[model samples]
Target: MGDKLSLPLKPFRSRGGVKAPHRKHTAECESVVMPPPSEVLICMSQHIGVPCKPVVKPGDEVKVGQIVGDNDAFLSVPMHSSVSGRVKKIETVTMPNGSKVQAVRIESDGQMTPFEGIKPPKIETRDDFIKAVRDSGVVGLGGAGFPVHVKIGVERDKVDTLIINAAECEPYITADNREALENSWGVVSGIKAVMELMEIDRAIIGIENNKPNAIKVLNEVCREANRDMHGNVCVLPLKARYPQGAEKVLIKVCTGRVVPEGKLPADVGCVVMNIASIAFVSSYLKTGMPLVTKRITVDGSAVNRPQNVIVPIGTRIKDIIEFCGGYKCRPEKIIFGGPMMGLALPDDEMPLLKQNNAVLAFSEKEAARLEPSDCIRCGRCAAACPMGLTPPLISGLVAKGDAEGLADNGIMVCMECGCCAFACPANRPIVQNMRMGKSIVRSAKKK
Candidate 1:
């Protein structure tokens, strides 16, 4: 009972998800420092909302943490230069989401000079706290890229619980796990700060039981703090399940509250944040460093050296792979994030963004797709869907171009966690179909 305590709370379970391979080759590897690249392609539209406008033009000199792009939109965050460099040009690049975004190209001077204005933000109130968070350019580093200030700026009275998602539930992505282990103090401090700012009394850090080390470290950190001063910051070990880190599922598991469809966690008196996002809050408050670099887990069957690496934002994927000892074999596919919901890259030239937690390179053997046979009607897809939607039926409707029918079947609610596809014996692309169905529904709504 020195540091660990076995709470009597039951482990929450979602409706369905497959027990895929963890393949966490770099779970034990401490994150290595990646050298800055010769050039960077910082995208202006890295976050979820409106794309930022470039404040600096070509030939303009910039320093690390200098705001290069910004937007007045409340839903957006500023983009900063990760390296001291001169602006090469601004060009259009296709993001993994298949949308074209403007990217500022910078030729690195290799000095890594911090902006002169960099200093800890003064925050005496909630508005100041939110301003500091926004100024730091923090976002959902767990791959969502949602602006953090906008997420936590909700009405304090509306949120009773704050859930820290430490459940690196996806296989092979250990960035979050490493953050929880090495940055335990930052994580805990961030939680306390958020609690004080938001007036939240209850906070839970949800880590999968598989990460016993991280769970232990976080719990120890919390235990060392004054419980009376910090309120309740509990590190709860969750069941190891796919999509366990999804906001809806996490809220359900951690608080035993269902985030209804067409609503948010705030609507249900909860706020969810990624572990890295929380840690960034603590780091930013101390150093005033914006979200310019990211911790990425570079691993897969084709990776020569599977390890976690901290890289500056806008570093090319090719450089990251090379820094990890290059590929042992040619990768047939490279994905950003985890196998469950990662976006497959058409090439490795894409630059890393703030939300990129992992870059996985898969060899042909691992990336090979199995020929999908006719549906066996085994109901495995339905059994594995966490949303309780019937994947097979929705997939059929999507194949038939029945957008209205797909909408009627709740296809838009699909998180595309790939649980159904992984559990399918027939190798059906249930998640892909669900994505198509969602797109179809969106188009229908637009029309």
Candidate 2:
């Protein structure tokens, strides 16, 4: 059955999982509060699919809710201003990866007013409802930023189940959990909206046991009368594991189905949506809010004060740092997302995007400073791989610039979950090599 496919064979000596210093309490105990910035920097390409085309040029006066960029791609969403301001410029800026991309710069007028018809579209049929959602530019808020419409757009005949990922398994990432706890109604409504759009009968909510309060809140909300969400909504308490919040891993843990490599959850007759995505969707259905901003965790040792903040999509990192009482020590490294799966920032110039989950500021002492050591041939990296790929072999191939050999080992499939890097006693940058291998393979393929 599909249930059987969801559970993976637990290895006798599993090596892919790593235990990093959580540093979650720095922000976990506090609630997310709004921290508006003086200016915003909306990146044209925030989602996974395609970048939005800038609609307004420099010097155009716009309100907070105005659409600044709109792409024709069905998988793309329009970008909006978080603060009422004038278009300062549309130029390329350094991103997290140190690559320059088209960015929309806006000078804030200090007013948070949305454009007219910011009201939710009155949708009748499911198709219209879905179209509106796509137009709203909503995507997975759990760091993927996958277009919401595309997720629910799978052929009706194929999908049999919808899964809601409440599994806040990533350390120092509690935005999704906080959303589910504080906005249970929104979460429930979002689930209903998704179910209604997909016309699916069964939906499963997977929450990690670590968040008992969130689990309790969701359970109580579902049990209420007239919600019409009881028999259909099944909440599952998942085993606490790092990377358990990943789409594939969560699917495996909750439904027992392996999302085929390079295929989507729909391939297995299922659709997965993040809890924050669901909450955002529910609000979109009511208020017609585009995917402009989201809750992000600002936690780490470098920060004097660490707390989650509801930030606009284009807010600068410097603003969040200042809001959190600024850094106690000069941050040697700033990472977006978690220390485990997050990409390190070459500089803080990269504006917040829909895919951004947590903004982690690490002190030089906290950040790993280990130099690469000779691989002990211990096979620890291979053991830790969640995708069942041999990372050690891939890393070795990459070490010698053997792109073909790396590709043959399926190095491209590596999610760069950092399991290999974390588990390596030699402190080898196994994931970095894997990433380079992928880039080399991609470039050669382009030839």
Candidate 3:
């Protein structure tokens, strides 16, 4: 491994990251559960693994938490029905990235019924605990849809620390913060469960210092549960910073450990999980209900009402907006997550996925980008890159289609967190170029 593949020990700090506006309008708003949508277009590829195959055909009846899609692949987790309904049709739908994926549309009966066979799984053994998590269908609920079970199902001896990411670093996203406030017990219990079952000795809950309420509540709850927990648990208050919630950055900040390139947190003797994901593990272990509904922050300048709500995983974007009193004005752009590192949606009719933590509708003033000017040899982009990547160099290589050159310069290490784009005085599309450079490098490697 090269220098870029490691973290600096003497520094005891992670590299460059940017600070953005903290537009947390709904940070104090409690989450309300939205009524079931008329129908849900549940996609098969919600997680960052193999896309599941639809097991139930059109017209098949289903209850909430019933398996609708599954795959034999080890990386994939089973997908559950979000509402009691009948499958309308199985069709291929285009995602925000313009890739087509199979989706199952279900006509909701509004019954809100749970599956008849729902019950908590037995967890007498470590394998039992892993199986329960896999059956729960939870994933990285903060934003990335990495399967949760796959993260926990690692070699026991390889891991000694479990890090819970409660740092909702992105602006306008308070869903995770609410989780810490509303269900602090769940957060503590979930951490203890993982630590006990996995035999981990240390657990850290990383929260941005801006969320003092969340930090207060979580610390109180963890203290209350100190006698019940198997190992030590600390609620570490992190400095408020963008990309603070990113796994790699969180690992470095919380534990001073660096995850090597092409490796995972577990490789560095740690397991990092999103706050909501771990909370869901506790809920599922108690109630046996799988992941179907997700908490979302509905806000932005275009929103009529900025609030937090819990909606079914497959609810349409427009429906969620309507539930929030519709738009304040015509939205020029709709983003899936936060302003930074979020995907722009081509259509709002597309259903919500498991990983989406926020639905942002932006007015023209907020969404419009300044015309990019020539790079003036300014190093702000490099200074802001969390992975120490030079976006200008990567952009040049991408323009020339020099994939090997991009690879040699550690372009693949770029996390696409948009720190460069946010820091650029020239308004350059460096993050987009970084994406292209990584794509080009990946394609060349495939060849």
Candidate 4:
């Protein structure tokens, strides 16, 4: 379900994750537009593919939605300026992945001016739709950051069903929920547009049963659609479970289809897009604006105001914290997403990326770490893993440097969803070991 899973493997546990607490603190707080950050650091490598090269040099005045970084790579999408300002400088910055890429620092003029070149795309054909999607800079808004255009640009016959993922199962994240409630029409219009352009058979919008309001709003919108816009789209309420929002997990639960390892949803006659991503498509098609802002939930024990804020891309985490009434206490950990699979940034200086759905800051007590104890071999980790892989086995292989065994056991298939770590009474760092084991297997392959 995660990007780390690539190897083909045997059947996995259809349901093998923990029922984590749904810390939907800001579920009812409608999203508010955050004032533009004094400065923004737009990264060149926002998506999963090749990093975009800078198209604007320092001292150039650019407006919102202006193309600032771009690459010709099919897997890549253009990066646009989130604010109207002068490019202060272009500097090589370290990304969370430990790689360095050029980052454009822009001094926002506070006017929130738009680029004159912003325009709605003409979409008469499927190619036009795909191109428009790419031009809109839409990616996986659910935190995958994969280029949406490249994913749905396959043959018309390849995808039979289009799945809209409205299941925001992760804790402390309600951006999708807000989108469903506020932009129900946008979500439905997006689905209708995609289905028409791609010639897909039907569309299913999956929302967890936990959010009855979101589900109800979506169903009402779909039900009240004009007669010509009816029946092709429907809503399905799913059991709320952690990692239920994972692409493959949602697909299986919604369609009873298991995307084989090393394959994509398209291989199984399906395409999955995040709820917010598709809603943005409808908005972009009308406004011609690229994805320059994001609606993110800001919460945790350390935050003063726990609510959703629509922020410009590249706004620093510190600024966002300030906007959210600042910290109630000194944060020991600042995560860029949900606690389960979110990344803990080194500091608040980091800029928000395209896929960041939530910013969670926890105090030392809330973020406390427990020392790992000897495994009791109770198999909780094994039972908790969605892939049914043995976490202890992987950890042992990583410790013994047995890359062969790790690879044979589908080490790469570990999505690092952290279910094992969460379920382990021993507090074992199984996900960390999986990351290490994956590195060893990668090294072995390269050797």
* Tens-digit per-residue lDDT, 319-379, candidate 2: 8888888989989999999878888888776788887888988999988698887879888
**Using alpha carbons, what is the TM-score of model 1?**
0.96
lDDT of 1 by residue, 5-33 (tens): 22326556567877878888788999998
Report model 2's TM-score to 2 decimal places. Answer: 0.92
Poorest 10 consecutive residues by lDDT, candidate 1: 1-10
Query: Which regions of candidate 4 fall more than 4 Å away from where they truly are?
Result: 1-13
| lDDT leader | 3
Q: All models: lDDT? A: 0.88, 0.78, 0.89, 0.88
Which portions of model 3 show Cα errors greater than 4 Å? 1-12
TM-score of each: 0.96, 0.92, 0.96, 0.95
Candidate with the larger lDDT of 1 and 3 = 3
Stretches of candidate 1 off by over 4 Å are 1-8, 226-231
Model 2: residues >4 Å from true position, as ranges? 1-16, 26-30, 225-227, 399-408, 443-447
- Error of model 1, residue 193, in angstroms: 0.9
* Span of 10 residues, lowest total lDDT, candidate 2: 4-13
Q: What is the lDDT of residue 227 in candidate 2?
A: 59
TM-score of 3: 0.96
RMSD of 2: 3.2
